[model samples]
Target chain A: MELQEKLKILADSAKYDASCSSSGSNRKSGSGVGNTAIAGICHSFASDGRCISLLKILLTNCCIFDCKYCLNRKSNNIKRAIFTPEEICTLTLNFYRRNYIEGLFLSSGIIKNPDYTMELLIKTIFLLRNKYHFNGYIHAKAIPGASPKLLKKLGLLVDRLSANIELPTENGLKLLAPNKESKNVSQIMEYVKINQSKKYVPAGQSTQMIIGATKETDLQIMSKSANLYNQYHLKRVFYSAYVPINKDNLLPSLEHPPLIRENRLYQADWLLRYYNFKVTDLLDVKNPNFNILIDPKADWALRHLEEFPKEINTCSYNELLKIPGIGVKSARRIISSRRNFTIHLEDLKRMGVVLKRAKYFILCNGKYITNKEFFNKKFIERNVMLEERSLIPTNKEQLRLF
Target chain B: MNNIYIYDGDFISLLNIILYLLKNNLHPENIKTDVYHPSLFENTIYLSILKNEKIIDQIISAFGQYAMRSMYYVFLSKEENKELILYYFFQNALKRRHKIMYYHNLKCVSEVLRISNYVRHETHKMKGFLRFKELEKNILYAEMEPTNNILFLVSCHFVNRLKNEFWVIKDNKRKIISIYDKKQFVIVKEEEFKLSQKESKGEQNIEFLWRIFYKTIGIKERRNERCRMNFMPKKYWKYITEVKEEL
Candidate 1:
């Protein structure tokens, strides 16, 4: 096949894997072609609005496993192409030099088996590192059931290693993808955690799970992600809203991807990582799914009403972060600014605080910024919903006359 | 009438003005650079450029390195009335020591921090958005029109990463170019150095492959042009090869 045709096929197949971050690696260049930045650089953005940080492509689209949720399942009739190690290296080098990409994100189908596919990935990355002296960031997927020796070698070569826990629940995995087991994904995470002393995966490992594919609730997903973070010390857990590409009796057919729900999950994930919120704090038995009208953070604040009207001047950094709109940067700003000057209502606006939502939850100098019914839960909820009304889909049928 | 001092718009010149103001205890009505539009109300005084290195060392010693760095960032910003803002910031920094930066409630302190943050943000964005095309003799050249004077900040990052390669970064907005010779880099005005327009052979082929990869990588079912614009703004789409087709 032609090179362009092969690239098209491989890139199309690999677009579903959502891990695009090139952060956490500060690999310095030593008489090499490139280096990694600590904060990472995004070279471009795809039309889908996803960051095009790396040259995300697969080695080949030929798979031995038939996972029903995947576009590259064995039963699907689609074009398949494999890239030679030389082609992969040339692509990465040219892309990096031209400043089109920060690095390479190489994923592949199980060509013959798990081990063989991993070896192909390793050989390509090893050639890039040794022959071309391309010291840029490289993130590679760890093939489940691959030999430990192969996994270790792959780990040492790349900056980051990821093994996606494809489904939120083990039963979902068993039902949708019978060939794949959650145990294999956990094993890779455990391997990275245990082998940290060897400097394996310097940027650390991350896992991803598909949302809206099965009958799992948001509570279950958060609990699973919390457990994963506690046990494996994973750097991140990506939540991909399921986009149905193949028709199957088991899969849920939807008009659109659950983008709003996916966005809520990401917001909750941020609260977990930065805001120090727990799974139980955000959800309970009665409200398992997030309210589509309001964001996860605001929803949490409304539920815990007694915590409202936090004094901005005297509140701790942790307390400030729990307010609906006070993010990490603004919270830190408030802490530093309050040390020298008394924080007034006007000062909060200058500190980058989102006063639209924060005014309801916080008090400046022990007085409310506005005298609304902040203590009433329903009033606050209605105002927040009004603010987020743009996100709601408008009725096209009513507007047809215009 | 109050006095409004004007000097040549340069970092060292600004530092010298700050030092002179500090030593004399003269609270001028305003301080502006040569680019200032003269007004009939205030008395205008043109200050000569003084070559002094002690002012830099003095500011660094008094305010600490972090403050000096942020002050430099503020100097690089294209904010209007920056000189007056800097004067107020320096006066406050002298009194409050290093803690003045944390006093975000003060108008001058917040303005200084805000302008510095703006410059820093532009520098970081240029690090990602600037696209290098291979020139003749294997020299890489990139052209950008960043909002702030960030050629020096962005070039420093590239010097460490691409240490083995010869490269040039041109800021079209400021008309300055940073040329790296695999060991050291020199920043010169655009008139002092000229770059060839000829591209290296097969550069087009690599760019073509990149465009193809960029086109195919996006999911057809989830195309959100608004979201794409949010991250990579339309203003930056002019130079990026992947989205250049739309331009």
Candidate 2:
């Protein structure tokens, strides 16, 4: 097969992995071809609105295991291709030189077995680093059930490493991917966690969980993510909405991918990581799923109405973060700006705060931006929903506005 | 006298004029660049451009390092009345000392912060969206048309990242180009240097493969052109290799 044909096949299969970030490690290119930016750079955006930061491709699409939710399952009749170690190195080096990609994100289907697949991945990455003298960012997938020695070596070479927890619950894994086990995924995470040091996976490890796959609630997904953060010291937990690809009874059949749910999960995940909010604070058993209308943060603010009208000028950093529109930067700006001058409501927009959502929650110098009647829970919820109404998919056929 | 001070559009010259006026306590009606339009009643004073090495240090010591950075970024901006904005920003920053940056509520301070943020945002976007095409003898060339004068800022990042390769980044809006010779880079105003893109062999094939990879990587079900345009604006599509006519 031609190299272009193989690239299209492998890249198409690898698109489902969903972790495209090339951040968290600052590798210098001293007398080398390229270097890694600490903050990461997205070379381009794909049609699906995902950032194309890395040369994301599979080493091969030929699989040994048959996972029902996956498009690359063994039973599926699709064009299969495998790239040689030399081909991957040349492609990554050429692409890097052209400023087309930040680095390579190499994952593979189970070519023969776990060990065999991992060795091919390691060989490609090693050739890219040593043979090609490419010192840019590399994110490699840690194949489940791979040996500890190989996993450790892979971690040492790459900037970031991830082993995906494909489903939020083990029950989902058993139902959809009967051949796979969550234990193998955790084993890879545990190995990387134990062996991780300054040089070994300096960007730390991350994992992904497929949302809306097998009846797992947002609460369960977030709870699992929180557990992963506490247990694995992961950098990011990516949430990919389940796009129905196969004609199987095991997977949830959907016309459109549950993108809204996936977006809500990400908002909640950010709350967990940055906003210092617990899973319980955002969701409970009663409210298992996120309100498809408002974001998780605004939803939390509405449920706790007693916290409304916090004085923005005198509020602490943590208090400012709890308000609907104030983000980390805007919150910091508010605290710093208020030191020099009193922050009126109009000044919040200039400081990067989204006043549309924050105005319902905060006050300036003990005076509400709107009347006190607008502070009621129902009114705030209606307004917030209206603000986010554009994001909601209008219908099955209509195109969305930019 | 309603004197309008005009200095060559250089950061140091702007600083010198501001300092000269402040030292003599001559509050000019406005401070503009050489590109200013004369009003009906105007007394325009053209000041010669000279590098004042101590002015930068003075500003740093008086208002702090952050103030100096904001002032420089505001100077690089393409905003209207940028000179007067910088003058007001520097004056307020000096009075408020190091704590001036925190005064986002103040009009002068906020204007400086906003324009600097705009420049920084463009610099970041250019770092990602700028695509390089391989020329003869392994030289990479790229072109951009950013609103702000961000050629120097973006070149600094590429100098360290692509240190072992020869590359040229041209800012078409400002008619400036950054040339890096595998070790260091220099930014110069070049209006007449023709860009001869002698393509290396197999470069087209590599770009074709990239376009294929970009087309195939996106999930078909989640094809949102709006979202893609939001991140990578439509204005940048002219130079991006992957965003072809079909996409």
Candidate 3:
């Protein structure tokens, strides 16, 4: 097959993966072809709202496993093409010089076997590093059940490694992808965590689970993510809303990807990483899903209204962060700015805190300036939901942690 | 005492002006700095801040190297009050002795931070948004008109990434260009050039495939122009390879 044809098939197959970040690696240029900036860089955003940072393509579209939610499942008859290690290196160098991508994001179906596919991936990275002298950021998928020896060697070469947990629960895995196991994903994550100090996956490990694919509740997914984060020390847990690509018995045939749910999960994920929200603080078994009407932080604040009317002047940084609209940066600003000035509602506005949501939750100089009806749950929900409905977000960067 | 001072807008010159102001114990409000804007008044001292090594060392030690570099970036911004902002920050820094950089609540410190943020953010954005075309003589060329005076700030990043490749980044708006001859970037005023082969046939082939790949990957179900505009603003869309086809 021609190279263009092969790239189309491979890139089409790989697009479903949705991990388009070339971040976290501070690999500087030192007699090398490229550099990885610390915070990462997004080269382009596709019309689908996905980032095109790296050349996120598969080695080949051929697979041995038939994961039901996947586009390149073994049963589906699709075009398959494999790029040689030399081809991979040549393409990456060409693209890097042309400023087309940050680096390579090499993923593939289980070609023949896990070990065989991993060998091809490892060889490509080895050639790119040793022969081409490319020092750009590379985020490669760790083939599940690949030997720890190969995994360790490959881990050293790439900036970041991931073994996607595909589904949140063991039962979800069993139902959708019978051949794959959640344990297999965690094992590699555990391996990467152990080698973090040794510079194995220096950008740290990340994983993804397809939301809305399984019957698992939002609470279950969050708990699972919390367990994965706590146990494996993963840097990010991406939640890809299950974009139905197949007509299978196990898959959910939906008209659209659950983008709003995905966004909410991203918000919740942000809260977990940045804010002091534990998984339990956001939701419980009784409330399995987030209230889609408002954001996770506002939902949490409204539920715990007794905690509202907190004085901004005397509140701790942690307390400031818990309020609906105060993010990490703004909270720190509040802390530093309040040290010099007696903060009022006017001062809070200057600090870039979301005064619309925060007005319901905070007090400045013993004054609650917002409407008195804000004390009621329905009224608060209506106001907050109205604000959310109006927020037609101009841009949300594609290389998001969630 | 109200003799207005003019300055060429570089950090070294700005520092020299500050050094003279400090030595004279004159308030900075009596002075002004602009990048060669013609002054209406006569007898005004065009601030001749020279590259004196001894004073450079003194300035470095006084503000710390990070602050000096940051002040340079902040000055590069389109801030009208940049001179006054940097002056007040320096005045406070010299007074408090290094405590002023961390004093974010101060108006001078916050204003400096805001200007630095603009320069820093644009430099980072240019790192990604820049699109290079394969030209003749084995040269790579990327043309942009960034919002800030960010060409010099972002040059080092590209040089590091494409170390062994000869390339040039042209800032169409500022009429300045940086030429990287596989080692270091040498920025010059923008110059005109013709395409060597107009468009190499091989280059066209690769460009064709790139345009195709860019189109195929966007999931039609999840199309959001607002989100895309947020990342790759409309200003950059004219030159970006894949998105250009749509326009």
Candidate 4:
């Protein structure tokens, strides 16, 4: 088959894997044909809003395992092609010279066997770096169940490595990707983490979790992610919203895409990483899911109104960050601006602080500004919920309010 | 009166003349002449020859200390409203020893500074954004006509990144290449240069592959037109092979 035909099949197959970032690599231009920049280049954005920085393709679209979510599942009827190691190397160098892409993102299905697929992927990277002198970013997927020796060798050559968890829970994995086990995936992640700390995988490791595929609650997902972060030291835990392509009796046939939920999860993820908020703090067993009407931060603040009326003058950086509208940038600005002069309500507004939401929780100088009559915990909660619902009247909000 | 101080359209010579006027505490309006006929100014005056290195150094130092650093570039670009900038510089320069320094706070000065800074940042960003594809001639050709003076800044990055390989950064607008030899650099005007041979089937095939790769990788479900445009502007679409192929 022609190289273009192989690229189209492989690239199309690999598009669903959301780990195509060319960032975090410090590989400078050596006496080589290509160079890698720290700020990962985005060659283009796909229709899915993800940036395509690398020539993301698969070694082969032919798979032994039939993962239900994957387009290359054994049962699915799609034309398949595999590129030779030499073909991939030649294409990479040609593309690199033309300024088409910064690097290559190579991921493959279980072609023949895991070890066979792993060997082919490793050979491609080796050829690119050694023979082709391509120093650009190379992100290779660690095929699950590949030997420890193969995985280690793969880690050294590529800038970043990933093993998709595929699904959040063990049951989810069992249902969707029965051949893959959650423990084996986590074990590989643990290996990647240890190597990364010892300067093995300098770009670090990331894994993807398929959201809404299983009946797992948001709390469960967050707790799992927190455990993954703590235990494995994974750089990122990507949450891909499950899009049912294959007709299965087990899965629900949703009319609309779960984009809003996916967006909310990303917001929740940001709160966990940057906002210094815990998963349990964001949601509990009783309220096990995110309130889609408002963002995770706003929802949390509204629930805990007693923490509010925070003094802008005296509040610590941490205290200021806890407010809904105050992000890292705004929080730093507030800290710096306060040193020059005492801040007022209007001053915050001028600094681009969202006073509409912040007004209820904060005080200019030990004074309640927004609706003093609703200063109590219940009244504040009610008012905030009303405000949230007014903004976005979700079905859940409609049912609760009525 | 909107008095224009026209230079000989040469950067270094214009810099030297501006330094001479600045050292004498003379505003642009005070002296001018018709050096170059069609672009001549009636009030222009030819600056006296100051061959002494020390005096030249003092004048350049004063220019740096008094004149708005970036406004000089704007002035060289022959942008409109050059007199107001010169007027503001003179007014500020006369108030203090380096009074023109105060005019650095003017809106035009800030705009120039902002533009220069943006250009510098974008050039740095392009160092990462640049994707070089090899041609049949073994020439590692990559064309980038950035929105700023990114050619110089990007050249520094390319020099370090491709230390082993000789390459050129062709500015499509200026038709100049910042070509680097082993240890030295020179700008070559390649007005007649075509990027690829018109009949090169290999180049056309590669272009086809790039377009396929670009189109196939983009996820149809999550298309953010704004974010896409923000990173890869439409103006740059002409130079980008993949984008051009798609169009």
Candidate 1 local lDDT, B1-247, one digit each (tens): 8898887777888878877887799888888877777678888887665668687888888888878888899888888778788888888888898687788878988788788899988888778888989988999989888888898999999998778989999888889999999989999999999778799997899889999999999987778888888889888777888887798
DockQ (Cα-based) per candidate? Answer: 0.83, 0.84, 0.58, 0.32
Q: List the global CA lDDT of all models.
A: 0.88, 0.88, 0.81, 0.71
Cα lDDT tens digits, model 1, A1-402, are 888889999999999999899999988889888899889988888988999899999999999989999999999999889999999999999989878888999999998999899999999999999999999999999999999999999999998999999999989999988889888888888888999642578999998999999999999999999999899999999999899999999999876777777888999999998999999999988889887778999999998888888999898999999999899999999998887879888878778888998888988887876665456888888889888776644433213323
Q: Between 2 and 3, whose lDDT is larger? A: 2
Worst 10 residues of 4 chain A by lDDT: A392-401
Two-way DockQ contest, 3 vs 4, winner: 3
Tell me the tens digit of each residue's lDDT in model 3 across A309-397. Answer: 78888999899999988889888987876676677676676566888778888888888877766577888888887788756342332
lDDT of 3 at B168: 82
lDDT of model 2 at position A249: 77
**Native-vs-model 4 lDDT?**
0.71
Candidate 2 lDDT tens digits, A1-402: 999999999999999998999889888878888889888999999889999999999999999999989989999999899999999998998899888999999999998899999999998898888878889999999999889889988988899999988998988898988888899999988878888887999999999988877898888999999999999989999999889899887777788888888888999989998998999999999998888778999999888888777998787889888988889999888887877788886788889998877888887888888888767988888888777888776655223332
Instruction: Write the residue-wise lDDT of candidate 4 on A1-402 in tens digits.
Output: 888788888888888787778888888676787677776776666545567778888889999988777789999999988899999987787776666677888889899888889999999898888887788888889998889999998998888899988777888889888788777787789888767743467788989987776788888888888888888887788888776777777676654346567767888888888888999889997999887766888788878877877998889999998997788877876786676467777667655578877777888877778768776767655666667665442433245435
Model 2: how far is B11 from its true place, Å?
Answer: 1.2
| Range of the 10 consecutive residues with the lowest summed lDDT in candidate 2 chain A | A393-402
Where does model 1 sit among the CAPRI classes? high
lDDT tens readout by residue for model 2, B94-139? 6889898888777898899899999988888888989899998888
Candidate 4, residue A187: lDDT: 73
Better of 2 and 3 by TM-score: 2
